[model samples]
Target chain A: MTAEKLQVAFTDILKAHQRISPYIHKTPVFKNSKINDLVHRELYFKAENLQKTGSFKARGALNAVLQLKEKQTNLKGVVTHSSGNHGQATAWAARTTGLQCSIVVPSYSPAVKMEAIKEYGAELVECGPLPTDRNAACEKIAAEKKYEMIPPFDHYHVIAGQGTIAVEFLEAVPNLDAILVPISGGGMIAGIAVAAKHIKPNIKVYAVEPEGKILEKSLRAEEMLWPNPPQYLNTIADGIRLQQTGHLTWPFLLQLVEKEVFTVNNEEIIKAMKFVFQRMKLVIEAASGAAVAAAMSDQLQKLDKKIQHIGVILCGGNVDIDKLPWF
Target chain B: MTAEKLQVAFTDILKAHQRISPYIHKTPVFKNSKINDLVHRELYFKAENLQKTGSFKARGALNAVLQLKEKQTNLKGVVTHSSGNHGQATAWAARTTGLQCSIVVPSYSPAVKMEAIKEYGAELVECGPLPTDRNAACEKIAAEKKYEMIPPFDHYHVIAGQGTIAVEFLEAVPNLDAILVPISGGGMIAGIAVAAKHIKPNIKVYAVEPEGKILEKSLRAEEMLWPNPPQYLNTIADGIRLQQTGHLTWPFLLQLVEKEVFTVNNEEIIKAMKFVFQRMKLVIEAASGAAVAAAMSDQLQKLDKKIQHIGVILCGGNVDIDKLPWF
Candidate 1:
């Protein structure tokens, strides 16, 4: 897909915001003077970690489900394959909107996450841990039950729904010079970058990833790159461990995101998570820590000194205390 | 002091709110339907854990300091003896208002807390952990340096300051049938009870305390009771291990607070803490968990069925991660 053809407009985000307004929280923006002093730049944290379902995934899920409800008069339900925040979000959105939803999770998925999905009243389908197995299970469920499948990050509606976060952030901090977002399947960054740049053309959007992810290599090559998952996946930031970016999201990234992708290692991510927990009194997951780590890294020191106001998305706070890295 | 003579008026709380408005945050009130279902009551949580200095102590400390600044022209400084939230709040209030402050902490105070006090630019005075030693050190500092002492609780201004929390709570959740507060020196509860009753004369105000504390005994006797701390203090809630309530605060508690004081064991407090951490995604200390435990306990089942909306004060979030009870 061409960049112009695949790009999400600001209008789509506005519509998504309006449609999902009742079901979602306009999450708070927080600032800490101590963090500002440590990073040598003013930081505005868009705290989607405190969002409904404990992540920004709620916005996209709600938007997709609502859109489905509007288009289909005889909608059976929705099916999605995810074992993380997206799964919980889809289940929550479905329950809130009075729809039957099925979540396909790998057999080895964390019991806590599976329990949360069950608590949200979603049917649970178990498959092998491999992505192909999960996808096959989801396809089978959709084919058998005639359930509409909500893609996690690649669909235009999902990207547009996620883009609503940038709309809120920009409204809260109108003069932010840049925004740093952790990239997984590229849905969040793709949406945020397109919306932010549309609103403020000169504002920079930087993608942050775990050190082992292929996003940086893909961004540099201006093409999709999927390294073997076993060889390259060793980071503790489980949320952004996807092997490659989505096709629909890649064009938005190419058109809207900055050229260089910021990367942080597992140790730095853990340190940042601990710092945010202790100093900021927030229980942010490691995936959110990746963006924070990049913001505090020396790599940002080379940016224009005049780029003083930086915004970071605290993506989620759905961590299992027993599995904490520090523990 | 007689109850009438020591009473804190609602006007005093209104004044304190105005005086400290510029300093402290009007902390957010949060509600989770899942938690509400588990507790069998609609719960509205006043998030003082997100307040300045990560506790509602900021309200009392700022109010007391501001009152001093208003009354005294040549205020040399202020002195307080505390090893917990009160000390940090006093330090933060003093630094924010450009006043010299000294905190007399026990030598056994946590290093993380001591470091925070120093970071707030307050003079640190180390003393023995015994109450007598801490009081003596505070008195010496007050006498030699002419520093006016800001008692942690039990002062008229301090109670008035803490009372401001009730005002905000009532404003946010106007028809709350009951409010549960963790009792330490009785300042926070005393203030809240006075303000809540003044605002809605029939609102039930419950005091929560750790098991074995003398608060329940003292409330039942309708007078001050100073049981030996070493004999009765065996709870994990270190923040509320006070031997007795203050002279000024006791009168307010007797006259304004509800008759029965709710007590929770250390085990129950830890369970509540873990539940809040997992469900609410909040990092609350043990003291805050006391109120949550009381709300979730069967004790509240005896309350009038008309009492539907319950408000709980999440008093603080200053737990030492390294020493977490679960960890």
Candidate 2:
């Protein structure tokens, strides 16, 4: 995707924001005095963790389903693969439209997530560990059943939906110096960067990633960072353990995002989670923790201090209590 | 307190809301479809747990301090007694005014809470567990130091301030059938009952308490029920283990409240916490859990079937993560 194409993506996202205004929550932005004092930056948290399905995934998922209105008459249903928040969002979106949907999940996924997905009346297809295998299984099922494959972060509609966060944030606080987002499949940050850059070209966009998995590296290198298998992959922030970015979202992010900063280990993530709970009194998942961790890091401290206003995307709040890393 | 007096209390609360509008948050209201289905009531949760200082006590404390217009000229400082939310609120209130303040905390108070109180730059005075003793100590210190005592719930200004929740809730969701609130010192519920009843005379006010606590007995017996020694008691809902209701608040509550309900044991509280965590995806402490537990009971479910809009006050969010009794 070219810079011009990314600009067009911002236009699409802004339009989606207007279109989905009725259905979606215009989730609030919260300022933390303690966080600002500690980070030495004026932080405005875009609280998408408080979004309808406990994640910004809802925006993207809803955007995808709504965009299918042109194809709604001939649509059989929706199909996707997700380990967590995306699956729930897809399920919720399907139920909202009264569409039959099937979500393929890895067998090792948390029971609570599976329950949430099933509770939304979406059919669950459990598969083995490999991410590629799960996608392949979802693709096979989609082909057979003629269900629309709503790729979690790759689809243009999904990017457009997630991009609305930037639109809302910019509208709420227009002088943002930078926005930090947790990147997994790249859909969220990709959309956000495009919208933010279009509105304010100087607003630096930073994607936060976990230490081991680096979609940030892949986006910068402009090639797949391959052979980086999930080696002892364990983090409390389960939302962003993706091995690869989506083909559609990757190029878009590469063109727009300024840099990708990886947070410290799981210990830091858990510590950040506890910090959020104690200071802000908000329940955010590990993915949100990763963003906070990045923002508070020494690496970002100087840039954060230089900025007049900074925004951090609190991406989700769907934390499983039983498996809470702190517990 | 007469119905007319309660109406006056609400009028004061409205004024307090105006005074504190820029400082306080009109926290969001959320509904859980699954929990609502289980309880068979359209449960509207006013999320004051997300309020500043993680409790509704902020309202009363701030209001009390703000009402010190005459004393402002001679204001040496403020004094309050609490090992929990009230202490934090007082500390926060004092900080807002950039005034010196002292908090009398029981010896058994959690370090986390004490740390928070200190973080607000309030002077910490640890006293014996008994409220009478603490009050006496606070009085002695106040007399010696010329500091004004800010009684947590007993004061008129505090109750009026706390009553702001009911004022906001009624305005946000008018025609609510009932309000379920967790009772401790009774300031929160007393204020709420007074305001809610004034607005909607038929509005049922239910106060939820820990089973072993005295609020339930006091409300039922139509008299004061004091703890054996009137000392701090051990309970999961540390924030609500008040030995006695405020004399000022009890009369207000006795006149306006419809009923007081009790939730048995820490297990029930934990179960309620789990319900909020999993179904509602909101963080509620044990105090809030008591209200939820009462609202979910079989007895409450048998109430007016037409009672579609029942609002539950999640009054606080401050829970010691270390002592979170998930086990």
Candidate 3:
């Protein structure tokens, strides 16, 4: 008899949805008349900002940890290196699932995120700001403690976990002509594109990368390539400024996401963030703002497709309120 | 054989709910585990921050406008005196009901509010910064233009409209031991106390007033009295700083709401606002924050009645983002 392997199949997303629903929120979908008017389209915002741990990271993290619980026995707790939403998400998931957690955060990571991870009862470790430093620190902890390493996005189970968002978003607004997604390590958009296209093949997937063309530049190569040294720190959208796409996530992004991924600058991201706060009255992080910046821009209107009803995943809302970028 | 008179009865709220359901959003009820752990009690927040015009004022305003539309024929327009949420709400209500609207805003009103009122296609008239100035200007406009005056609160229909919130809140969380409401002109709490107590006789109604204890002081008098000048501008919670309770709403406050209203200072209000932004990831106005402040305080835990399950009405989220009070 063949065993089910770890993969991001459509059925796996369904299973992930069932497994993670209890642990995370089915966050609300919001619509604003003024925002719709500004964009001249029927924009349905999937408010994952209100998700558990205040981001969609909750979905992937919980899905991964819960599956691990079912497969393994007496596993040394989970370990991950993330300085943002995913860090808190892993901690929350581990704590909820009755397991210990350790998060390796970059030295320059925001204090708020580190505090949140600690509040979830996870051991917090600080490392250098570089990607290699984060991974080395995370791997050392995993090796020394026999803790299972859960990469932020590359793992197939993590991608499957994030695919659940597409299921929920599509369920809420079934006729969404296309979905506008934010691109980080490509976990969310990859899962979203795969799941969304499977459900409705004609539904296009457009993506936005915050202040960097790494995704755009790398995809042009014959084979996928990661950024050198993998230390990206360019934009105000600190959350989505990953230097490269995940190895597993790259295929889905290259094959499914629209060719023209929107690249937005810090100012554009901030403008979109302000629009949501002033108009929709929802607090969204700059990573989500990049997606919104794409949604709010003029290019969507001039697209070739008759994209009337668009879905924008407001991916997170864990912003530092005291240090608003606008000021 | 007689027609239904304009009165804020329990049935009126039921009717208002039915009538206004199409126009307003049935906003979600949100709960944060972190917040619950901090307060040591489960708190259900009715997110009227996501309501139309970004406030629960939508419920009352829409009901009043729709009722007016049904009662009168060929009305010149509807006019109201409000410098904040109520102003934008009235404009949205009027526009939604296909009625001509004129808003008499105080000169000191925020520019964002004035812009919103105008954007809703309401004729904006600015008056001096005083209660008398606003009312006189509204009355003058109504008399000259034959526009019907829709008072911000104090009207029977308006109170009935406000009561609809209680119906929704109770429906969502039926077992709530008590409800925490933000008091402004008493329209909301009056409607809520009547409707909620009628729905569940055992339910307790507690109210919160932002700094400046007019409600507390007035309840001591022989008759329900308006503020000496009826103009109050204290505390950063500008949305709910009404100097006095409404005539119709005051009786409900005295009779149904617990005698001791929680009076949160500006500091407490701002603190609550910051907590919500940091944790729940919602941009709540200071007015809504006042209600949350009361919910977060230790007094609830020390109360005589066991408020294990508390319902808080986040009255609005029409805050000026650029001018956040905490900053």
Among these predictions, the greatest TM-score belongs to 1
* Sort order, TM-score high to low: 1, 3, 2
Model 1: per-residue Cα lDDT over B20-108, one tens digit each: 99888888888888888886789999888888888999999999999999989788799999878999999999998889999999998
Deviating ranges (above 4 Å) for candidate 2: A1-4, A214-222, A228-234, A260-262, B1-8, B214-221, B225-234, B260-264
Docking category of candidate 1? medium
Model 2: clashing residue pairs? Answer: none
RMSD for each model, in Å, please?
1.8, 2.5, 3.3
Q: lDDT (0-100) at residue B280 of candidate 1?
A: 76
Model 2, A1-327: lDDT tens digits are 435444336679878897777777888888888888887788898888778888899999988887895666878689999868999999998888778899999998878889989988999998988867887999898899989888888788889999999999999999999998988778998889889998999999988888777565666677777565433245667788775677677677677887456556787788888888776767789999988888788877666446768898999999977767776
Model 3, which residues run further than 4 Å from truth? A1-7, A220-222, B1-7, B220-222, B225-227
lDDT (Cα) of model 3: 0.85
Candidate 2 vs 3: which has more lDDT: 3
lDDT of 3 by residue, A1-327 (tens): 342232577888999999998878888888888888788889999999989898999989999998898888887699999978899999999999998889999888778778889999999999996778888998999999888988889987889889999999999999999999988788998889879999999999988887645566666553466646565758988778776777778778767788777878888899999999888888899999998999877777687657889999999998999999998
lDDT of 2: 0.82
Better by TM-score, candidate 2 or 1? 1
